[model samples]
Target chain A: MRRMSWFNATSLTLGFVFLYLPMLILVIFSFNASKLVTIWAGFSTKWYGELMRNEAFLDAAWVTAKVAVASSTLATVLGTMAALVLVRAGRFPGRTLFSGMIYAPLVMPEVITGLSLLLLFIGIGLDRGVLTIVLAHTTFSMCYVSVVVSSRLVTFDDSLEEAALDLGCSRLEAFLLVTLPIIAPAVISGWLLAFTLSLDDLVIASFTAGPSATTLPIKVFSAVRLGVSPEINALSTIMITIVAVGVITASLVSKRAAVKRRNEEQAAGRA
Target chain B: MRKFALIALPYTWLVLLFFVPFLIVLKISLSDLALARPPYAPQLDLSAGWQGIKDFFGGLDFENFIWLTTDDLYWKAYLSSLKIAVISTLLTLMVGYPMAYGMAKAPEEWRPAMMMLVILPFSTSFLIRVYSWMGILSTEGYLNQFLLGLGLISEPLMILNTPVAVYIGIVYTYLPFMILPIYAALDKLDGSLLEAAEDLGCSRFTAFWLVTFPLSRSGMIAGCFLVFIPALGEFVIPSLLGGSETLMIGKVLYEEFFNNRDWPVASAVAVVLLLILIIPIVLFQRNQQKEREAGQ
Candidate 1:
């Protein structure tokens, strides 16, 4: 059963290569000496230097960062509240509608979501800018956050909160002391998920952002639309590397936590 | 009281932001296009009272929807989008199945690392992932150079800015979605069932067909939906990777709103897109409902 058959091994290798080879190529070519992106003559660090000095890219990155941080924080709070309602509320009016609204945005097309949101902002005469981007990002990403946090909530031990209640605590106090600390990991992951989502968004940001405010993705899209340049390749490489490191580090940390918990539980049982 | 506050806050936010905006799109889809700043006509002016309400309803028409049917550009875009989505979803399934099967079939201790490897690319920005293909698929790109160097072809292939490139981009980016669900389904499958099938005089291939493949059906369906739904309304792939010859409803919708400044017609296009999506969305919901009920 543990035998590694050639059939499975070949497919896995080829499949991963197919999935990753393009990005690998893009990363390798980022250091190319040529102005034209595809043709590589020799190694150079000029594009990275150029990327640093490009004010437009820097400004866009700043806006994107601000939007991601603010929106993800707001989304985390709203989404945690939404998750509490979903997991704990019973037989409330509009329960079905509430759940429906939470799940619908996860599958809604970006174009549709963006367009609908834009019209809403315009209909009420809200100027499109950073504020609008934050609003739009918060609305959609909050759904993702709720989905993340709620999955953890469904498996949560209610007896701990009950124990807190039995100790003469109020409902809110019980929740803060018992429920939140237990679910903090999921909540933090939810925040990170929302953060990445906000950072990755281009279509929604484009619709909600005014001419005065541009995001990094919008800048990359417009630049790539003109044709691929070494600077963009350098930029893509940086983004990919950062995400790669972050994801790897996260998985390792979670893995170690799981292993430590299992070992401690075993030791406690043996003792 | 606190529970009510908890429920009401998100509820009100969704109602105002999500639900109301959808109704607005539906209303604008019915209204006429204007040269005004907001662009659509038949604005529902509450200030004018019952008279304004009556005039608004009277002025609203299905003219833009009728316009959608009359123009063949929108029709071609719809059909092409459907075609591309169907093909790409199939391609993604073909590429992702073996990988997911491999992950599920791997030895126990290696699974976590393998799973992380699969998900790592997905954490990167989607636009960057799609843009990665441009450097490889361009005529003078690495792919052509490699093929020509290998003597695989006499001349470089023109893959970029074509439907083929769109298929690649979609399949590449959405492969993780396809793999994850199917892997879940396969990982849950009992290995003993396959062993018993083989013990009952079935060959290895026969046992897999009889016992394993059928069990993975739910995951396959879910994975297909995950890829197909987003691919249908994808704008970035077509606009960036596809040539001018390529047409998709999402790209058209974007052009209508931003390039042409025709809000009513864009809303009409969106309405039709949603109508098309409703079928799959309903099916997906029903499938999930069935799975949930079955799980219980």
Candidate 2:
């Protein structure tokens, strides 16, 4: 076995510390009794309690949840379709352009995407509100979902679908029963990812949001810009906790599924 | 029929929602600004049908683009954005390379957890993460306080409200993008190749230099572009962290659109930014195509 090099050890420790230090600091300071973010006077849950009492924060969070749910669901459906077309559909007309369009949004600057979509909304005389935000988020987030689903699709065994067809199931039926079930995990993960993205996005939402459709990120951004109070830190800590719990739960579920699959395969081999 | 339905649904949605918007932006970019409800001249009248379309095109001009060229602020913003993006990309790579390498070298069982750890911060609210940096890097923040306590500094270092803070904020935010791709590249590397080099009397460092670094070039490039492209258009980090000195094009575009209400000018800026981004966009597409072909 290769020994752990000093360089590797130092890099791992330092890298993790660098990545987590700001977040840890934010979390610890969220409970500080002082209004000032820098000084740690004493620990208290007042800020968290105050955050709970903030009506604007509560409203933004509700808007964020609505947008995340709507957009992620929309993105998953559309993205799954796009992924299927890319992976399973034979070369169709405008295949190259279609692929480009699918992937272009992945790296397109948020400002540009936001700006362009805003312009589109204005040009089409559509109202800029939660609907526009959902549309924008869905459009961009679906591209990411398509990428994830497409990678999984590329590795999928087409023979299974072919066999299902041979066994008298129609293509749609087979896909619904077999392919969809198998790719459900990827689709779910994609939805989760899209949800997180929609939730985290401030720039896009800022451009597309109407007077009454403020998202949590936009709200947080405005408050943070004004000043970094413990209230914002308290909000951040809560947001971090939610994300951490979600990710950890997702990871554990996937891990357990993998182990179960392995055990089933082992039993089948023994039989 | 099923296939047609599947294809038509998303394809139509993207075309209407994603592709056509760029055309609208292009159209707006060519129009002159006006003090109207929508704030641009030559508004397309769909009610007039074909004649309205012709009239719209007829009224469009390159006035906004011309105005963009005359302004030094736009040029400076573009230049500063490029400079900062390049520097930040390099910094992210330098920091991320080691972290990625270390993660890839970690035991197999720990790899997933390590990756999850790297990605956990990324999943958290991006605005919050940037806000967290302010608490650490401000003059009276944690960094200054710690350094003072350790007697490492005489005065509170002017870290915040500078480009240094921007760099730090960027590196912190984009670090995962840099790390994930490089770790993937390193993880896929065969151990036997390194062992073969070791048996041939090469040291670990030399072997890594010759074998690992060269192999990881694509991942590095991928990571760099991921960081660089977004960093170029980054508005939040510079505004909140870099103070007034940071003149990224994204901020400029934001100001022109919202502050000045120059929708035409903002559209022009977005058009030019897209044009500037075309090179990397093409490069990235080519890389993806090559990867797909390689997979095949």
Best by TM-score: 1
Q: In model 2, what is the error at residue B226, expressed in angstroms?
A: 1.4
Docking class of 1: high
Docking quality of model 2: it rates as high
Q: Which 10 successive residues of model 1 chain B have the least lDDT summed?
A: B286-295
List model 2 lDDT by residue over B95-201, tens digit each.
Answer: 99999999988887888889999999998988888888998888999999999999999899988889899999999999999999899889889999999999999
DockQ, all models: 0.82, 0.81
Per-residue accuracy of model 1 over A7-73 as CA lDDT, tens digit each:
9999999988887888888888899998977777899999999999999999999999999999999
The digit string of per-residue lDDT tens for model 2 on A12-107 reads: 999999999899999999989998778989989999899999999999999999999999999999999999999988888888878878988987
lDDT of 1 at A214: 98
Q: Which residue segments of model 2 deviate by more than 4 Å?
A: B46-52, B288-296
The number of the candidate with the highest lDDT is 1
